[model samples]
Target: MTLDFDQICALLPHAYPFVLIDRAVEVVPGQSITALKNVTGTEPFVQGHFPRRALMPGVLMIEAAAQACCLMMLAGHPSPKPLYALGRVERFRFRSPVRPGDQLVVTAKADKVVSTAAIAEVVCRVGEVEVASGRLSFGQVGSA
Candidate 1:
């Protein structure tokens, strides 16, 4: 399945400036998702992150990847959406700087899922070059 900007917004709780994923190109319910984020010079972080050289922060890249994983996990859920929280991030590595005009393609695959949590492997790329990659653990909100 594919998701547009509005659809992405509906699946996520984040708002403008924080909403990272622009669109989901592909999605496999309860399995994986491939999403996109178009980096631009207009992003608020560019001004303060580096006034002279704008680079997308590694943390934000992880955030984007995590969001993609959240989408994948949420795809199979029923209505009255369950909240998802970042439980942990592991083995995150930044391979290159992501700059303005770069189209970030992020892919996330569910590694494992239990009654209260889920683990996913995620990666972000600019074309064929990998910009960031990591594993993320998400906890189901209000679950123990």
Candidate 2:
């Protein structure tokens, strides 16, 4: 099932332009998720992130992927008390520039679930080619 940005906000704490994941394409409990972001020229970052050739930053790509992981985390846990954090990023790469009008798709696979933390393998892609991939770690901030 897909969750719109408002629903995403209901699930996650991120807001506004910082909420990189536009919507969740697929959400499976304790498994994996796929999310999407439609890049646009009107974004705040594009205004000054090189006005001549505005492009989405690579870090934002990772953030989007992380937000997808956040979605999956919320789907499984749903406690509303755990605050997600980025613990590590491995094997991440920015293959190409993400321009306006491009649709960024992020896929995340839940791999590890510890007593208080979870890890996921995440990939960010524009099409078939991967733009970034990494291992994302998240932890709960408080008790249920």
Best by TM-score: 1
Candidate 2, poorest ten consecutive residues by summed lDDT: 74-83
Local distance difference test, each candidate: 0.89, 0.83
List the candidates' TM-scores in order. Answer: 0.95, 0.91
Report clashes for each candidate as comma-separated counts.
0, 0
User: For candidate 1, lDDT tens digit of each residue in 1-144?
Assistant: 988899889888778989999999999977899999999999999998899999999999999998888788776577767778999999999999999999999999889988668899998999999989999999878521
Name the best candidate (by lDDT): 1
Could you give the C-alpha RMSD of every candidate to the true structure, in order shown? 1.8, 1.8
Query: How many Å off is the CA of 137 in candidate 1?
Result: 0.4
lDDT, residue 141, model 2: 69
Residue pairs with clashing backbones, model 2: none
Q: Report the alpha-carbon TM-score of model 1 versus the true structure.
A: 0.95
User: Model 1, residue 143: displacement in angstroms?
Assistant: 10
